[model samples]
Target: MRQTFHTSGPVLMGDQTNSQEFHLSLEQITQAPADCTLRYLDFHGTQAKLGVEYSGTAPFTRDGIKLSPAPEQAAPLQASWCVTLLSPSASLAQLQQLMRFFDGQQWTLVAADTLAQRPECTVIRFQIEGDLNFDRARLSCLRVADQLGADLVIQAAATQRVPALAGFDMDSTLIDAEVIDELAKITGIGDQVTAITQATMAGDMDFCESFKRRMALLKGFSEKRLAEIAQELPLKEGAYELLTALRALGCKTALLSGGFTYFAEFLRRERLPLDFTYANELKFAEGALTGEVVEPIIDGDRKRKLLTEIAEKLNISLERVVAMGDGANDIPMLNLGELGIAIHPKPKVRMQAPQAINLFGLDAALYLFGLNDRQIEKLG
Candidate 1:
């Protein structure tokens, strides 16, 4: 059977176009066509031209903007995945390239929305579906994104809803500086301690051993100095804004750090609206470091356990949890949450994380929840 369509302007089909009207078979509108193309106005009202190919079983459409078959004849499966691209230099040309990449992979671009747009950064979310090999597709998308100087996050649309519990790592994730490294600087052992910190974070050395060694170096370091550093800890850009938005959404938030409790607690009490803070305790004697940490260090395994415990205590399912961090020790919890994001992580951590944000600050994470800038501003 054939379907007829009339348009005020041009109706593009393959290499041909009609100024007033056109006709297409049901198969052509419902099924992908090899060596053909469709040009249509996208939901954003921009002209999008996509190459189409025959895929006997797959449904294809670009934001429901394409000429479609009758509702009863449309394919059952719609978009099943959500891919968000964020960059400081995102442009229309880059987005078109991404659409082409999707088309080449046999994935349909179901919809595209700009979540945030500004000169400094642009965030766009693409809803897509196909026989996706999730990992392979993510890696492919990331490669393309790298070429475009963008950060990409791909997730199942089912689990892309706003999380009920959001967990974050402290050092280098929420804060601009690592507390231990900063303390090391104040103690005049910055070089030695920073080396261990870097190795531990990069997953080269054991976090426990590194912590012990670094703490021993700070033995006899005065509490006054620690307090001074805590009071001035630099927050990562957009940390406050992100946390504020989460609070407005009534989401339970936690600072799940492998750093010290003193610093983490300081952030909770004075800065962010965090519901819980978990970290190691430094044993203090006579207001000086005893060079010993409290037992049961919050290593990678511990962080994961703590995240699970928090979810249980709040009666929230793991699928509704979002975990973000930047170190090797944060890997366990990152993988535990339904949405795991590595924030400016080391090379190793980034490779293992489900998603990453490197080009922008923590606030960019909001876009991953399918939120737009207007929604975020409303939350504030």
Candidate 2:
């Protein structure tokens, strides 16, 4: 459908003829990347603060105002893409930066407008002037979107668990951070520590190597910090609701990760089944880190092995298990479950995950299990 957007106001979608114009927000559009091609970005027709541009044979121009001809389209001899500021997740200033990178690349583009609300995510749509080289630009666009977290559009769904066992990533998966990493945070090395955290999550680095490097960075870190961070790490959205609902349905609930125990300690305190939390250990020197890890990094392989063991012990079949994760490390388990769920996962992880929960929150995972909001509230 044709939509009209304004630089100062909101973008109008659906029936633009109507006086009732829906405004999109930067927030919705900026849910960031969903690890897919044109999934949902924000709720469809939702207002977004979008900075849109066109790059096809007919630069998306209406009355001389250019619009990007959708996401993927052919240009001329030079490959180009229609870059849009779908939302302000990255901000107008950020879009400008992207433009600067795109500038003088022998590419032509027209920045038509900006709007307020986020929009639905969709696969690439093109109105190419003609088929031309556009692969480079498209790839660049994907990378920009990923780096900015302006890569996805959230969809709509029910917030509840279906009747089934729910698997969780223990570290950042359930709570946050490895016990050792949290300990490092107390010593004021959080930024360095989190760097390893991100790489491990992104699947850019090897799990054990990454874990050890981050662990080594934590030398002189204290065990006390583990207890402290455990008490403070934020819970993923709907984590509690998910656990409660799953248990109510007699579904198995488990926490598996390549993280550590200190953070799991928090969930354990919460009194959730947690079922099982697997990860490596951080040895402490009296109170601080000893700059060494206990043998056998739990890594991805171990996580899968542990899942197998847990399934066997519980007398549950892998087909009945549901796995969720955000990084490639979790892929093994995600593939192991009957229904592997990717929760706000990275691009690679999402593409491989059997099912994805892009709407609502973690509670949305409950929906696939057959639980609804009302049912969940009843459980509460």
Candidate 3:
């Protein structure tokens, strides 16, 4: 039994016992392959993916031959790409020559991404068979893939970068407690607020109208307590870095939340380039829950309205904007943008988003613009 592993990570040079480590960058000059994967690598080759044979965890085999990770008796510290020879009957010497041609400088490989795949491709697919960590192994695979003339199909991971607008969901996205629910908590009507919230987000209730209903329940929360809870909200991970990067890129940012303005403004005060923000306002009278909310609350429709309004105000196209959220409330706003990428969205939310980022941190949104690892390092 044999298996092919593709991975991408830090570069390895020479032999492990006495070798140097340096970044091995790759450049793709031609059309990519059908696909590839880094089960053991990061090179996701369209060609490889297209022809892959998965037999319920069985090793990949073609005809009667098993696809070995590496050939037996292969040289140490050597890499080879398995390309179908012009002449299937070509001698091993011809194969070696073909491999040698690609290992030369004409080809460049980075991680698992391949630069070319066709016959003009005198290039070949490279494989490095060795034991290493996932990160290390991924790098080795790409290094070998590039060295052998074939492009690594895997892409370089994104690094954080530039200023871009960030429209937030103040309630759960930016802060913890929903102001409406908290008011309910304070007024001893927590169940009422929560019930309305779930029903509204579940699409079972009309956003604005249901929101008005919740606000009516909080008609008189005190202004002092709004300040109190604002201090207690926890910012999401990498929030600062994400904001700083976006601002650096000259992004027009704002807070688009269903939560109250009370806590949203508190976040903007830390020096974020908050152009404007929108959310429902709790009608306050004294320092306690009023049991009634203000009218014309910012609901789901309001979010979509604000998205269009903001884009026009910034003198930018919706294509230049990126919105993130985890609930159904974000869908309308998301649709108005050029690329609505879901960030750790709900199952339904993820399904609707044209682009989605779930594996990396929320800041991974930076990758959508094609910034490389090195460029991202400069952002911080």
Candidate 4:
């Protein structure tokens, strides 16, 4: 049986555009039968001399005609896309289901790389080709991921270059706990401050206003207690590994947080090897908190500006930066990076950010950079 394929597109000839249609048989395009012949009229609708020559199954080319095996040619209308799926408990069944879903959409999967594999987490990167509809593709993948209890991130598969700079939010991103809420606990106003913190992170309340209100409740909180809490602050799982890998790749790292500098600096000094740390400063007098932060609060806008300034000062392009955060206030800085990642962010932040990772540890993000488990292990 002869299978026919129809392809149509606008062909530009000098200043005129004409619709050109080609009806090719499967064998002619794929196998190129020895006796096969293809003929088409000139764009001017006049009898024009043409020549065709085939040499040992090689693709045929003429002055105005080119034919090659479909497998060797990329359709002009298609684009490369990256779909990354991560889950703490992903199974082969889930991966197969996602592959089937992509097949249903007619997107050709060019490659599937399992970046990480462990009982606690699994990361898989899928490189596909299809017409670009990022929003739709994201939504579709989100739906599938949700069904599989996984997190899916989709974006154009641009040239894979290790980022030069990485910026992170402190609260709920690098660490599992919110610094402000931790302070509230020490002030004996945990419930009240926690409520405001939740609202601010969800973008329901203004960050600056909420910060002041929370600070007022912590008036006179002991600096001794703050230092103790900083020491006890739990780093998020996989954070250290992620930072170590970034350092190995020669990437400058920064903590751009709305949280206080005391804790951020502690993390930089004792915990992570951060290249820079920027956060609000807490006023202290007589070994106690004064409930007032220093001037120039590092709110959302400031976070964005700090990320930009650091990149500029370091002579790094914005395209070679990755920003990760978990709050609405982090949205600006997150969007400023080439890869704006929401690390288990608030619903509002997850919806607004370009990509999110909710299913695994901070290290799962390395897969987005196209690093496989072997590469990550070598980096460490």
What lDDT, from 0 to 1, does candidate 4 have? 0.72
Range of the 10 consecutive residues with the lowest summed lDDT in candidate 4 = 1-10
Q: Candidate 4 regions off by >4 Å?
A: 1-79
Q: If ranked by lDDT, best first, what sequence of candidates would result?
A: 1, 4, 2, 3
lDDT of 2 by residue, 1-380 (tens): 11222222122344232111113443433333221112122222234323332222211122222222322211112112233333223233344444454443543332222222233311211111223344444445555555644432111112112424556776555553455465556678887877777777788889888888887877776567566666677777667767776777788776776766655655766646666676666677688777788878787777778888888888877667677777788888877866666776767776666555433346555434433234445677
Worst 10 residues of 3 by lDDT: 17-26
Model 2 C-alpha RMSD to native: 12.8
- lDDT digits (tens) for residues 203-245 of candidate 4: 9999998888888788898888887898899998789999999
Query: Model 2: runs farther than 4 Å from truth?
Result: 1-164, 176-185
> Taking the tens digit of each residue's C-alpha lDDT, what string does model 1 give over 93-183?
4555676777789987776556654545656667787998888887787788777677888888876667999999999998999888888
* Candidates' C-alpha lDDT: 0.74, 0.51, 0.48, 0.72
Which candidate comes out best when scored by TM-score? 1
Candidate that scores best on lDDT? 1
Candidate 4 structure, TM-score to reference? 0.77
User: Which lDDT value does model 1 have at 186?
Assistant: 81
Q: Estimate each model's TM-score.
A: 0.80, 0.57, 0.57, 0.77
Output the lDDT of residue 67, model 3: 28
How far is 163's C-alpha from truth in model 4 (Å)?
A: 0.8
Task: Please give the distance, in angstroms, between residue 127's alpha carbon in candidate 1 and its true position after superposition.
Answer: 0.8
